[model samples]
Target: MDELDEVLPPEVTATLTEQLAGWADGAVTLAPRIGVALVLLGLTALVAWMAGQVLTRLGRRTRLRRNLVDVLRLVSNTAIWLTGLLIAVTVVFPTITPGRALTTLGLGSVAIGFAFKDTFENFLAGILILLREPFRIDDTIECEGAEGRVEAITIRDTHIRQTDGQLVVVPNAQLFHNPVTVRTDQQFRRASIICGVAYGEDVDEARAVIEKAVRAVDLVRDDVRDIQVFAHAFGASSIDFEVTWWTGSLPVDIRASRDQVVAAVKRALDEAGIEIPFPYRTLTVNAPVPIRSVDGQG
Candidate 1:
């Protein structure tokens, strides 16, 4: 090594030595900045997590709907993380300005949005849903042929627990774009069953009997108006009566009330000797005349 250094020119060797010393000095100066940036990033993550938890707890204390609360929490966490990220980036790249940062983020976001269009669409739809409160968590809703109780509403999807015990993850865009039926919007809902009786049965009597029967069902709510029995249609074999009554709007309550009403109606009609006739058809045969053949047979 000594011989090689001696072979090189003294000025070249000194210049190389100075360049290496400068590089080493710059690296030593950069090490602490890198450490500080990492520390800031870690702190930012911790702060974001804590902010999310705090906001979630605060939201629970309010009367806000669950979906709204979740939205607020998510936004808070994102904001906290973004703040931390800005601070971390500034530490690493001191020359970066807010305008430049935003410009870069905007371009990146536009590209990401195009790539994940459906995801952003669902996210925006979810935010709207949260704000509008079309259907809150635990509310029974039907949308796009899917009916269930809302379990959760996230930025991308809605979680529904169907009546049949299946968990459905539906994109928020679908629920937002389509008509959603909030069955439990009101406390009580009207339920009706079409019942028919024999043609010979007295319409008024059948109506009275059905009103009494439906009123007797325990699940049927009587606090509303009186039970209504209207002769809705004239069937081929029987007269149809639309028996309407009020009941709780929940699926379980609706089913139970209907079951009870059906049983009561059947029992009451049987006791009254009122015949609930089955569908019947009648045939008519025309008398045929025999024709004589060409042989002139009588």
Candidate 2:
């Protein structure tokens, strides 16, 4: 030790002694309690970090494991923070009672409930969403007029990827009250398209063209043999025709499929010299007869 002492600066020892003397002699006091609190915090942080690493390793294997990682992280972090807080309370107030602590906790919980009521509700909602399995990740769902594939469901909100590539976050509270429509929940969905043609166009020919268009779609269902194109209506502009098809076990890009079907029908009708007519309103008004008053003031 004496041979290794040369590395220490001479002022280091002097400063150390002066500080210790000051603490011991009551001239000054360093808060050992503060140091101890920091130590406890450091220990909790280390444990939590280690837990995170384990969870991350598991997450790499599967998507389900990835979600579990978030859950484990939350539980581990909360437990560690609670342990640190207990230690802090015990160290700061040596005479504190465990029963009194319980009472305090009860009261604090009530206050916390009032303060973070929405937060707690959302947390519980997340648990229910996971357990009940109303929908799964990547399932196409519609709620509150927003349709998309479910990106993820976290504690606060459920995220979805819209057809337009938008990220939408819907609050759990709203979900609890709102009715959700899971399109891909049963592994299939039906898509329908409405097209109008001129009255002079051959209805059978137009129907054949629509059937061909539906068939041309790669993702369109093969069992769609019940397609019917009727004289839907007599419009001020043109006749309306409806084409419907059934789909099952299809991808989440159903909108794209519908757009494709529409495009195909337009092209097919255009090639057949059939017009998808647009409404043309012509307003006619007659000039009012000149009003003549009995007094003939003009």
Candidate 3:
């Protein structure tokens, strides 16, 4: 300090020397606490891992849903880590007690919640979804114009593999608030298609033919539910029959059954000589002057 003062201004030298000394003393004082905090955090990591493993095994043994098990594991890890961090913090700074830490955290959480309102909403919704089991992974669902199989349900979002092979990450809150159509809620579902025949075709006969054709479809679950054919509407050219049958609930299953039913209905109608009509047109000219025959006579 005396050498620095001789070469430099006394005021600057004094201030610089004092700042360096203070920082060194502070670091030395903090080193042991920092080491202890590190050790505690290491222990926290181990405990969190152990807790996760235990929960996973317990869930499997108890035959809990996969998503529910995941939620349990996540919550356990979060709580353990939070507690461990609080303890480590208090050790590093003896001035911060658990009560004070909690109070500070509570206030911080309010700000965090406001800043991430949607995130919290999604997290809560995800928890409810896991608990309620409204739908499961691999179940096909339709919501908000997105239709697909559920791949995974995390705390913030759900992963859906769409029918066309696109992956969609949908926020959990949206699903919780809106209506979700679980296509595979049951083993089988009812599907209907309109089959229009010529207006002159017998309605009763068409209905019978359609019911028989639909029942013959390999994918149709006629044993589970009856095949139904009702005279539904009259069109410009044809009388429409509402053909309905029970089939597998999956989208692929429905599509396959529909394909077979359409083919079978067409084949049956053709064999029965029932005409599936096209629109017919009639023309009348206001001033009809002449008519020409094959020989061009008028």
Candidate 4:
């Protein structure tokens, strides 16, 4: 120290040497702790992977829902990783007790929560949705005018495959807050279509014909519910019958059933001489107007 002071300023040399020695001691002491922390982290990762595999096998054996099993695995892995990290931190810094570490974490969480409010909201909503399970994977659902089949549900969002082959990722919060229509909640659903016949046709006969036709549709489930045909409204050129029947709940099933019913009803009405009239419009003018020919001849 005295020799270095001869070449350099006493204050600067003494401070620099003390700092260098302190850093060297810190490095020597911290090296083993860092190595231990790294080993612990590796063990944590290995354990997390093993836990995931075990949970997956248990889920399969127990026949649990796939989404629920995934949720459990995610939660378990997070907890294990957090525990390992906490232990590693304590090993490195003996001054930081578990209570102090937790308090610090609580303070940090407040800031993190504010930064990722939507993410946490969606995560909580996802957990709730998984528990409640109003609809399942492959079930058809409609929400906010978007209709599709549910392909997957995760901690953040849900995947829906639309009929036109588009994939929609909907946030769990939206689903939890809004009203969702589960189309396939039941095995069968009722469908209705307006069938109009000429005003001159008998209402009772038209109703009977529509009922018989709808019931004959292959996709129609008459065993579950009877087909119904009622006089609904009067049109300018025809009387409308509300033809309703029960059929499979899936969208494809309903569409196919409708096609068959429409074809059968048209054929039945044609055979019965009941004309399904088209709209007839008449224009009335207050003043008389002269008509002209395309060739300008009267």
The TM-scores of all predictions, comma-separated, are 0.80, 0.60, 0.84, 0.87
On the 0 to 100 scale, the lDDT of residue 55 in model 1 is 69
Which scores higher on lDDT, 2 or 3? 3
All candidates: CA RMSD in angstroms?
Answer: 5.7, 11.0, 3.3, 2.9
Model 3, TM vs. native: 0.84
- For model 3 the local lDDT of residue 237 reads 83
Q: C-alpha displacement of 31 in model 1, angstroms?
A: 4.1
C-alpha RMSD (angstroms) for model 1? 5.7
Q: Tens digits of per-residue lDDT for model 1 on 195-272?
A: 999999999998899999898888888887678899999998899998889999899988889889999999999999
Inter-residue clash pairs, candidate 1: none
Task: Give every collision pair in model 3.
Answer: none
lDDT of 1 at 207: 89
Off by more than 4 A, model 1:
1-25, 29-50, 63-70, 281-298
Candidate 4 has a TM-score of 0.87
Q: Each model's C-alpha lDDT?
A: 0.87, 0.76, 0.92, 0.92
Residue pairs of candidate 4 with colliding backbone atoms: none
- How would you encode candidate 3's per-residue C-alpha lDDT over 1-298 as one tens digit per residue? 6788899998899889899999999999999999999999999999999999999999989999878888999899999999999999999999999999999999999999999999999999999999998999999999999899999998889999998999999999999999999999999999989989997878888888888888878999989988889888878788988889999999999899999999999999999999998766898789967878999986
Worst 10 residues of 3 by lDDT: 276-285
lDDT of 2 at 208: 89
Clashes of each: 0, 1, 0, 0
Model 3 spans > 4 angstroms off: 8-35, 63-68, 284-298
Q: How do the candidates rank by lDDT, highest first?
A: 3, 4, 1, 2
Better of 1 and 2 by lDDT: 1
